[model samples]
Target chain A: MSQHISFVQREELKNKPSSDALGFGVHYTDHMFVMDYEEEQGWHDPRIIPYGPLTMDPAAMVFHYGQAIFEGLKAYTTPDGTVQLFRPDRNMKRFNQSCERLHIPTIDEDFLLNAIQQLLLKEKDWIPTEEGTSLYIRPYVFATEPFIGVRPSKQYKLLVILSPVGSYYGDQLSPVPIYVEEKYIRASVGGVGEVKTAGNYAASMKAQKEAEAKGYSQILWLDSKENKYVEEVGSMNIFFKINGEVVTPELSGSILNGVTRNSVIELLNYWGIPVREEKISIQEIFDAHARGELEEVFGAGTAVVISPVGELTWKDQTIQVNDKNIGPLSQRLYDTITGIQFGKTEDEFNWTVQVDEVRV
Target chain B: MSQHISFVQREELKNKPSSDALGFGVHYTDHMFVMDYEEEQGWHDPRIIPYGPLTMDPAAMVFHYGQAIFEGLKAYTTPDGTVQLFRPDRNMKRFNQSCERLHIPTIDEDFLLNAIQQLLLKEKDWIPTEEGTSLYIRPYVFATEPFIGVRPSKQYKLLVILSPVGSYYGDQLSPVPIYVEEKYIRASVGGVGEVKTAGNYAASMKAQKEAEAKGYSQILWLDSKENKYVEEVGSMNIFFKINGEVVTPELSGSILNGVTRNSVIELLNYWGIPVREEKISIQEIFDAHARGELEEVFGAGTAVVISPVGELTWKDQTIQVNDKNIGPLSQRLYDTITGIQFGKTEDEFNWTVQVDEVRV
Candidate 1:
């Protein structure tokens, strides 16, 4: 064990599923990391326990007030059979930001990160090694105070569960058709849109289902105020290439600062690509498409990694990007990120946090 | 004890607390109503179970994607010692609106209302008869499917829990100091603000806490885009009395349609008072204050009924309303609404739905 963490193994470990059966967030590991927080006692009793159900009072504030936030990252099993996490410190930093916004107490990021590695060591067999497969890690915090009032909760629970899964979008990288929505909004400025809180995703589900019913993969959200400037596509930050210049919307305090978006930007800067985060409106994108300057469109997020937009339909005006194929830059970003993740390429950015090499 | 409803009595019900100890959403009744929903099976298995903790998977969608919505209404003990729910059908309608927006299934409103009455009847003794007290009924629905994906859950849990709550604010109709917020937003047009969902409240907690830290009771939000037009107050719909006329923000598809707000409007219309739902700007309110036309400001919702605003502090400018006393109009609205609730006056509008008093 890496620290003072306690573990209770399952009575009987179940057989692992066939590698082919691993999909996104459907299957879980044998154990999880659990901790609790109180206004007075602080976060205490860090332990690893058998994965099971959680018992909560019906009046838990999380059910009524939505005082919850979560972080999603993955643990990759490298080609040399070593397990590593991608930029876990960044996730922890972002996690604290969410905690601050939701009025939850902060935790020792290094302690929690070490505890995550320990929990992973306890169930390292669950890490999938097939091509494009790894264990998806979900570390989340939620209000546990048993009250229905509309105030911040004084008690909370922080849990980290591991799910061995395949690709987030599909079995392979694919360009998805997105519908530009002008009616419903995912978020607006001065809202809880800059963090990975549960409510932001809840607010976006309606538009997502509407787009899904129309055979679109996701909803391309515009700014809620004027509904002109692009905000994001589904849960991911968006990027567009026009006249060999890459552009995305500014943070604007209403869109999530996606981790993959940051990584992609870093990778773009490394490659000396002309990338800028500024206000890019839907009309501007359409104009670029009309002028043959729109080269590519893609989304970046932890879950989907890199998702290219095949066709964008705005008010029945459908247009294809890069001839309905993934752009070379998008493919390169995906390949380099995943290659570094799987240790197939050089770890030039020192992004991956390698787990301890102690044998089980 | 009711149609299509099963009951599980507690082996040893705890003694009821003294009426004086009843606080908001803290003290629960002995039992709760629960139902489950599946995409294929619809909502089924409605029953009443002993009040206790509910066991849910750690990866339940409500903890992750925040796919949940809730409604609040109160059951008043009349002077005749009979119970009545105030326009519960409106709450049911609003609940369905939230359900639709969050991609949850709607229930049979009449059936659910009847079930609520039955639940209240089973726990009738817990209903407080204190001058300003009632049984605060909370009916909530949440996504229950154990998955980490960001889509609506196929399985849902609908629960109705009862709490014997005292006054929402202080007793005796005290006027409160509200902060006029210009930084953080509650919701925007074309957003999920028009419904009673957890995310909408989650989106406001940050600003609410900020206002509270500044020594304010609640926040008075402005429009998200312009941050100019008055939207709604925290957890209530606000009304402004100016120059012998009453006005509230129109239903702009981003603020909750409070049942009490509707009743207040209807009550004003019945009394031949000039009332309108239109865009009222904060600057206009300041101008009205300057012109001595800002007569009174009160918030309306099912919990508090009517909360008078004594002062509003915006951008370091604190302006007192009605000289920091309850204005005549605010007092009248509170008195009339609460009077009808306690059966002190005639139910002219046919608002209260009298629960059938079959011998228990």
Candidate 2:
């Protein structure tokens, strides 16, 4: 019921990578947070221990059944050297939604948030202070129970690990090509598409690989039923600037409600820019491009924040947006979101949670 | 290039349960087959080591991305005191297909099959000799690399574990009620439903749990497009006897190509029974039942062999089949297939693979 903290440090700390050299999720921090769940004991033995390999039974349900859910956010360092997390509460809320969908038990959000604050303090040194670098936090809950039946397991394990990651895109704020996937589908309605679960990601590798092989960086998925309406991009929510209004697909239980997607929408509303979350079709986008109304297309997520799109290739037709350059609106939105994230701009929405001042 | 295997014995052997008490995937054998894969070294270090917990990194791709695929087959002991496998080559072939879909590297089928034979020899005593019991062989490949990008892992681990499993269904050959899932969808076209990947099972837990709560033993999933065409029953392929015609849904892109289902079709052909594989919708099935044309409904898989369905509930409408008892066709199919499995019937198709005698 209360925030519990226990620590057992490593005998020797691992060498840290230079801020410039660290890529995404390649280097890990010193300690990690872990908790276990049982049918009898609600959740027990919450502790932070040395980051290492977990000795798991080969029959563990997590490896066999794919009953696992995860949340991704980042710890950022400001100019004044204050460590903070942006909208971690949103990640926790979505994590519970994924747990419910995957048939895993939900955690006490308040207890977890408090524990995260203490963990951030403990690993504060690992938070990257480079221009676009940050410490990535991966909180995942998986079925640890060793069973093979096609049902939920009675036991689970919640683990939180940290990694120093560079900017998601090597070249910052540049536009890239995305292929319109016609054969492989990501998630259909009434499926686990909207949830940030492991299965959703596994179902998408083939499509991503095919698109990459065709010289596209990612894929643009469509609705499974008609294969016309545009869905989310590769693990990120997509937005299209058509004519003047910014259009995005609604949360139809077939696409993820990304945290960064919400922030972008809020920023657009504040700026009095027309933004709409409704069904948008690939044909409509092509028509808009034909009429020279398509301005810019971009993707939003915790990792990239905003990924500008330069060209979209569908069938045999390719359309270049904003003359294959980063549009003005995309650059402004990126600067605003990242500025608020790094605490350089005024916090009007109170989204950033500072680590050192929060009570554990 | 050649068949090679290293062995490591456990310091102490674990206690084995009685053959009758051995549940599915619970008790393990003394040793297992493990092979590692790297980008440069394609599936190296083949060994059979002590069966125990596997030490995995916290960020291992399997736990987070669900990039894992598996095969389910059993090793049976005959009256002649000889051990043999049933259609393991088919399982290996399917395993490669699953691997291709999941973007994981495939194994050398001959080398892996040779390794499984050696592993069975190493733990020959664990194979259950009871009439309905057999050693369940579970071979799985999972992403071992600890990176968090949405791509194929450069590193992977393939492991084969044996569990002395009892009969999958305790009642042997009995009829049970199944619910027709209308709300929660399973796999659809262009999805991973046809593959034995972990994500497909993960996507079905919610529907299965809901069906079980409604007093049904399993769920009968309809096609994702219209929710009318019958896709599969629980995790098995389904069949129906309508007016003396044995019918099953065709190999649509949305259902698993069950090995037992294939065998059942072959057996029906061999027996000179009328069997058809085509699009059979739930409405047509209901119409058949209304006109007293529906005779029986059943499910088939390697685990259950054949499961007779007594009743089906759709939208609060329950249809009892064959007076809530196993029909003649269902009974005949169950007996013939399980007969061949236990080595009683003639294997005219040459489905059995006898294990060569070897000792550690």
Error of 2 at B163 (Å): 0.8
Question: What TM-score does candidate 2 get on C-alpha atoms?
Answer: 0.98
Model 2: residues with Cα > 4 Å off, grouped in runs: A358-360, B358-360
Q: lDDT of candidate 2 vs native?
A: 0.88
Docking verdict class for candidate 2: medium
**Model 2 chain B: ten consecutive residues of lowest lDDT:** B351-360
lDDT of 2 by residue, B150-203 (tens): 678889999999988888766557898999988878887998989898888878
Interface RMSD, all candidates in order, equals 0.8, 1.0
**Best by the DockQ measure:** 1
